[model samples]
Target: MFAMLRYAPLLAIPAFSSVAWAPPMIRMVLLMAVAWLTVIAAPSLTPMPYWSDGGGLLLACSSELLIGMTFGLAIMLPQAGIGMAASVADMQAGLSAASLLDPGGQHEPETLLGSLLLLAAVVLFFTLNLHVQLFHLMAESLRVLPLGAVGLRLDPEAFMAMVGSSFLLGLMVVAPLMIGLFAVDLAVAYATRSMPQANVYFLALPLKIAAALLLLAATLAYVPALIERVFQDALARLPSVFGA
Candidate 1:
């Protein structure tokens, strides 16, 4: 339970187990209760030869915690990709100023285009059962890197590669929209220059939003495929990312 609790937030990223909105005290109590239940239900889940001197137990706990964190982080990379795509699209659409406080207590940009895309991404995530896949990956990780066996054995290069690839996937998802928005920007610029007295900045926002929405609606069919590909790529890299 403790091990799982250490990584619960990571597991919660996909919306299934998130408790970030709860009061801190309530959240802690809930987590502790869950952890206790988990331990009670699965005694073997803990590190072998659990009883030890204080220093040894501390080392064991640290190693297990590290393992949980690594697995959790690896599972979270694809979601980061989703956030990246939304952020860039929001920026280009001039919707960066529109913001919301999410359940995690973070201020997130909230735009029509970005919100739509984020919703699509999340829907596809659940549709593809990637959350289940992540759970399985986490389980597999335990087999490959057992509790208290050692500290995380991540390869820096592999980790960087995963990060780079995830970001690239995000860029790919937003590429077409970006190009369309860029053309819109050029048109707006030319129009503004030709008519110096016009409120072009104000005018551009609506135009950009319209174009982004149109493009998004037109290309909506392709989003599932893009999301699926990114998800699969992330799943494929999970084993290497966690040294599984």
Candidate 2:
């Protein structure tokens, strides 16, 4: 029970993060699958025998939950890079105003490119077998951070670095599109100045969108490799985050 409880958040984050765009039924199924996986692993995991007292046990569980969530969050952030890049690209392309509710969560509206990039990230996440690596990391964390001792070693610096790197990766992925859009903007500006009567705003929207799409398609081949590299970096940083 403790082991399952400890890993529940770790399992939940990746499972849900990867499939956030999926239907509720699909998310529920993945979650259930993770639950079973955790349960199966629980028997082999070491239990915290020192936390015999109620207060100590409660604290230990709390620590475990926090640690698991941290680990999961580190793993999940790289997948978000694609969405961030898309958001910036959409804004540049004038598609920011045209939005759709993100299927993964109800809170935010996503642009078309943003949605596609998000889906791509999720697909890449699975294709690269990062989920398997995540599970392996969770199991190994037991050796680094034994139960009851987890909460003390939380590394805020490492977490912040993880987040910063994810954003940087996102920017790298979309930099080409952004630069192309900027060039388009420059062309539109030059045209508008050359012909004062022309409505550049009207012409710019479709042109920018077209350029963004073309650039995106052109760069699509490299996205998986970028995602894989960023995700692997995140995974490599986990031990430091846990103070291992």
Best by TM-score: 2
- lDDT, residue 15, model 2: 61
Give a tens-digit lDDT track for model 2, residues 121-208: 7778778898789878877766666545535577889888888988888788888899999999999989999999988888789889
Query: What TM-score does candidate 2 get on C-alpha atoms?
Result: 0.83
Clashes of each: 0, 1
Predicted candidate 1 versus true structure: per-residue lDDT over 77-189, tens digit per residue: 66677777767887898777555534453554455565676667677877888777866765555556554554567777777888788778877887888899999999999
Clashing pairs in 1: none
lDDT of 1 at 132: 75
lDDT of 1: 0.68
Per-residue lDDT value at 110 in model 1: 59
Candidate 1 regions exceeding 4 Å error are 1-7, 12-51, 100-109
TM-score of each: 0.77, 0.83
